[model samples]
Target chain A: MTINPYHDKRLQWVAYAIFFALLALVPILLDDAFLLNQLSTFGVYGILALSLSLCWGFGGILNLGQGIAFGLGAYGMAMTMQMQSQDIDTNPIPPFMLNNALESLPMIWEPFWNTGTGIFLAVAIPTLYCLIFGALMFQARVSGPFFAIMTLAMLSAFYTVFIDLQPYTNGVNGISPPMPLEVGSLVVDPYSTTSYWIVYAVLLLSTVVAKLLTQSKFGLIVRAQNNDPERVRFLGYNVAVYETLIYAISGCMAALAGMCFTFLTQYVSPSQFDVGFSISIVIWAAIGGRGSLLWAIMGAFIVQGAQSYLGDEFLNTWILILGFFFILVVRFLPGGLAGLVELILGKLPNMSKQQKSPGEKPVDKASLKEA
Target chain B: MAGVLEIQNLQKNFDAVKVINDFSMDVIELTLCCLVGPNGAGKTTTMDLITGRQKPTSGSVTFRGHVITGENEQMIARRGLGRKFQIPAVFRELTVRQNLEVAYSHEVNALKNIFSFSSRQCDARIDEVAEQVGLQERLAVIAGTLSHGETQWLEIGMVLMQDPALLLLDEPVAGMTEQEIEKTADILNTMKKTKTLIVVEHDMGFVREIADIVTVMHMGSLLAQGTIQEIETNQQVRDVYLGTEDH
Candidate 1:
């Protein structure tokens, strides 16, 4: 079989080169720390959208509660940072633990004291959660718009749980480390160049991971099932297993994004757990053209950059503008921005000349059958 | 040796309507069996039951001696049972060769399917299946872009890629040109020498071209089982299925 056109290696590498080159240009152009921090935030959002695209766009699973995994990862990072801030001896307790008047650290909080374990939990917890949750839902054959609602419902439940668990979660106010991250001899100042580079590295790593997955044999089945799952099943594929594995993988990506987001923002709040955040993640992917990884990442940057720029002056109007813009995009560019580019490339004379033969006869079956 | 397929006292009911009632049939190995019947005769339903798309109301479907009545479709399919739908259900977005590669059942493990790339042997086998179905030229073309006849061949090629022991094809050549029909008949005729196939078709000419054993069904039950010529002369099959023009 010829290589899938979607996985065109040369085009993918060029896109990657352009993306990283643009990212490299960012720090050089913008020397201001605040602006650099904002760019880093957008980078985190790009990872989030990329993760959503993997599941919803490529895998054909609309997980409206992707924020649940994101929120969990963020919480994991925030909790670890907070545990690091606490004294180990006379008052060996996290400040949030003191908020609920606890003298001793909880057993769960002990694991986050080590930054390595904390990072592991950040990615691992959400991955495990998705494995269990996705297995149950997919095995039960829950999918489509119904699957979306189920995920949203689950997000609401997790939100409630996070809010009610005041001792562990710090209630609705959430958890933020009182001090800059200090691991023995090294102190990671949240606003330092080190923090920016760390977040940047993580974002790049997340993108690479996502790219490898979508290009793998597993990714082939994902795209196939996205078209027709019944056909895949009849071909002897375990549809549930395929969906579950992809869902969990997607969750891991989101968790990585969340960990970086928490590191950049230095806080995890209840707002991150909202269903709207998850939906917004989906919209970001849609804006970029969910079908392509690079486009989805760029989509997040464009949409979030616009939101941040206009958000101050227009406040409430900013959201309405985004909604209107998304509607316009859906109407005008069904394949998103990347699809529009593909459409333009398809129309060019040279491309058109080469495509005319195969394009004219074979794809005309619908009209032919009508006659 | 026992028959490759043995369906004993098989019954299927959808809600209150009994579609297949007390149907029993056995086809020996490497046979091209054509099942002919009018509408609502449970011809497709029997295929579905054998392929585990539907649960039998009663009785067992034995493939190679193992009872596989209520197993899931994927499980049955992995056990070398392949089926082509009445409507050509192919991965429309994928290329024709990719369709065969996806259905190629050598590496059926879910984990292996994800991490592993298609082997050279798999590619060679796919090419062979494509050539067999006269789709070698259209291998790189997207399946959805293929003509109706081509899509039908692609689906058949997909089933053939698995090298299934028992293949259930529903209307193998319903909407094909005369040339395409002849090619399809030639393909099926060659395939039956090595594989067992039960084809359900309304096209009598295509059936006569390929069928060695013809079984006639009427009202969810078998009416007659014999050589195509024998069934053509059977009064009961002629009255219930074929009109009197066939002498």
Candidate 2:
């Protein structure tokens, strides 16, 4: 029988179906709550990795402050849940405020205690931050190393501010919400396996939404802008607007991931938003392939799963390995593992039609010389 | 027709070096003008000043009677002026069809872009433009994979999709083959029927074929402006071209 290389959509679907089937069986087979929780953590990381991919991969934005946005969302939910447990009006100050502090809670922290306000702020704060950052950087035509430095500086600034604001943020110790969330008569025991499933559902929905957006016309513009901003601008596009929009969207998605993270850990701390987390998320995207959304999720899973199995003794060493992996992929495998898979598949004897010709060369040598 | 582009004493300086000094030009209706000069003769700077890519040190540029002296690049572009860079700027990862679609200005929102639909008008127009540029066969091909000549054509096709009133092209056929150069001349010739075009190039052969009038520049100042034959025999032009040879 002749193999139809053009009809590989079936193979693609089957691969995804098998992967999900394996994931669904994990909770049933392992039965170990700790393992299940680790898997849930991986799901949160996957969401974050996917979000970063949208900005960095598609938009060509080297955002190093993604963890700050994620922390904002996680802390936003944690604060609201804390207020709910204390029987206080979900206002700025809980009724138990007198016990912890002599005066009122800060005004900015007030909106975060209400559930609706908390959810809104979870997505809003990061989006606003990214919008402002993007507006300044893109308008100034900052790119390459300058763009990377600006993002790193922003990340460092957010980290320092969170660490210094001990009174409101609870400083390095971080804030943890109580178990079994009680909102009015409703109690949500997040420790239950059902809560884990809910988090998974959110992850799947957000992934689908992100996938749709990446394939859309706006996504096309973002990708184009990445390759050539000047051309997009010449086409009468406000390149800054597109960059800002992508930043905001990625920020909101990161924030949503943080919300899911808070439900899993019931904690929000400065350490969670540190530069280390930011680097780890980037590593996830890089390992997956810079521009491929599916690869980003896979990268998160592979990295987090390996870390969980290997324990903390191997965790520090993992960073070194990841750094080497990044260098290797950037140098040898420009497309990462997914790109490698495609290459290997193309080389298969039966997949001749799907293969790209080997002799193809770059077209604009003179343009590069002029630049 | 009313003056679509009017420049008054446009001057630009880089540190102590004056790149464009007291440069002035007026473009009326659908006319093709070529700006020719030696390397570092401020041809690119002149185009930059008109397109709002580089702000002039001192000068005024009016487009469509609107004083666009200090407008931003995007605003200037939106005001019915299109620019094609000397470098063939294109989205390498996208297909030719997708590149044109993104360049088409039907929807401009960033948030709603993902759910937006391309109109049938957009598809038909893309096809028409691609066909005009002889790139219809390569519509599905990735733009980065195109030949140098093809990429230049694609960039021009992208600009054509915008359907601007004024077009600024810098060395549109810099590295193209002779045949490709002929095709580019034909494309520009066809476009001049409906659009005012200002092209900056060093290839006198190509310029002479398509230019309605040629402007010559030396040391950042306009040396002469007239038909190609008029400027070629001008004493000062001959002196400048010959004087540099003795050095």
Candidate 3:
């Protein structure tokens, strides 16, 4: 039971259940395996968008290099998956490593052979990186556009280093041609229903976790921090800690999404960590409605679906079309698709109702008018 | 009696200018002290120094037998000192009750606040504060949608939710109707019974109603300190501040 009438938790859950159920039905109803597999990729993209939404909308952090975390996750998974394919007992070093004149299998590549370790590193590496990086930025009291630019600059540096480590990383070519992921004895093929289910389950799980977090008492402080960080600090909150933690959480989600992407596509490349890919993730969140997680998910699906459909037809003008679309959304609908929902909900009976604002004055309307 | 709060030889300078110099004041437990000054008398700056918003160039602020110097606002606030701004500083998007809940959840460290909190105690505290500030009916109303007076009361309620031992208020009744000011005076008067209060107010009439002690500042230093009647008659206070005012 909720104390406030404004957010009826039961009603929200009902709506949430219905949406996820419909999403679950997509693979069952669609006969085309190819389209269903593509849908799974879109779901993974949606997770990336949701991560950005939480950071930008809820935490008021603008990370221009969100792909850094996503790329880390992708590379972690790719490295692990690549190791899974080789007969490591006899031929531990991959062909690329040998080609680069490596004397021995590097100690860093050893643990990634285990899927659990790979996934663990995939999530943990980005989270720890962000936690340390966030603490530095926030403790120094850097925020807004400056924070955004710093993150972007960091991604450029990270990308340069990642490219330079050619022997371990495979450089520009990236990690590819992995065997199907094995869990115990069960082989999870890229196109398999098990893989789709894995992505589906995680997307839903993370969304709920995100929802619970943003609705918690901690969330209350975070929102308060966003409104007036100084006031919240004076109210006795360590806002730097709050901001840093949220940033770290967002990074974890992005990396998780990246890991899922690698599982579905069986490939992870430097392109995933590029500036363009990071910007695309932001555009999806903004287009979908950064304020609402569900809308952000839909934003990814719609944009990726449109891109696939239009990329073949309008290969030259696709970027310009997307730019115009972004401009229109920003100009006409500042809140994106989620704002439209709020506007509509406002008109519906009992939907947007809260206590009459300006408050219940003891003075009557006549007295107020006279005053 | 040992002062509940003490400020001694406090100084704050901006480049070449001394905003507050040798500012000294002691607030006894459970007493209301109003700081009155002319526009450039450094009233606001003194509040900043006490609250640790700005570290003093040289001085000490002792609260509850502890010298809190060069500490940040969050740490100082956690030491049981609450502050209210001249403008209503309540979170605009949150409901009145949520704002109170946030203020009541005073642990401030995110890790402790993450998964769980004392909601049962917090909710009770919220209701109590909402009632105290006469916002019981508007608990669910968004703070941004409040009228100017209501917003001020909400901020007061938020500060009260934490139940700090000392409260620092800056212009608690700025831009209010006559009745709102009276209500605010009543709230401050009530608070002084259980908590020490440091109020910076330009409204002389309001100060006269609730101030247990009046400290007048002139040119970044204390000109006079005494009861309202004493401050009114003091030749120095009249010359520096009272004489120039609408009083």
True contacts kept of 1: 0.68
B128-148: candidate 2 lDDT, tens digit per residue: 999889998888778989999
Candidate 2: DockQ?
0.55
Judging by lDDT against the true structure, name the best candidate.
3
Clashing pairs in 3: none
**Which should have the higher TM-score, number 1 or number 3?**
3
Displacement of the residue A86 alpha carbon in candidate 1, Å: 1.0
Give per-model TM-scores.
0.94, 0.90, 0.94
lDDT tens per residue, model 3, A1-371: 12543355554555567678888998788877678779889989989888888888788898999999999988888887888877767878888888889978788888888888887998999999999999999999999999999999988887887788989888888888457677678777778777788889888987887777778777778888888899988888888999998899889999988888887888877888788889899889888888777777888988999999987799979988998989998898877777765565456465334222111111112233664
- The full ranking of all candidates by DockQ, starting with the best, is 1, 2, 3
Error of 1 at B10 (Å): 0.6
Give the TM-score comparing model 1 with the true structure, all chains together. Answer: 0.94
Estimate, for each residue in B86-184, the C-alpha lDDT of model 1 and write its tens digit. Answer: 999999987887788787767767677666765888889987998999998888788899999999999999999888888999998988999999989
DockQ of each: 0.56, 0.55, 0.54
Name the weakest run of 10 consecutive residues (lDDT summed) in model 3 chain A: A355-364
* Model 2, total clashes: 1
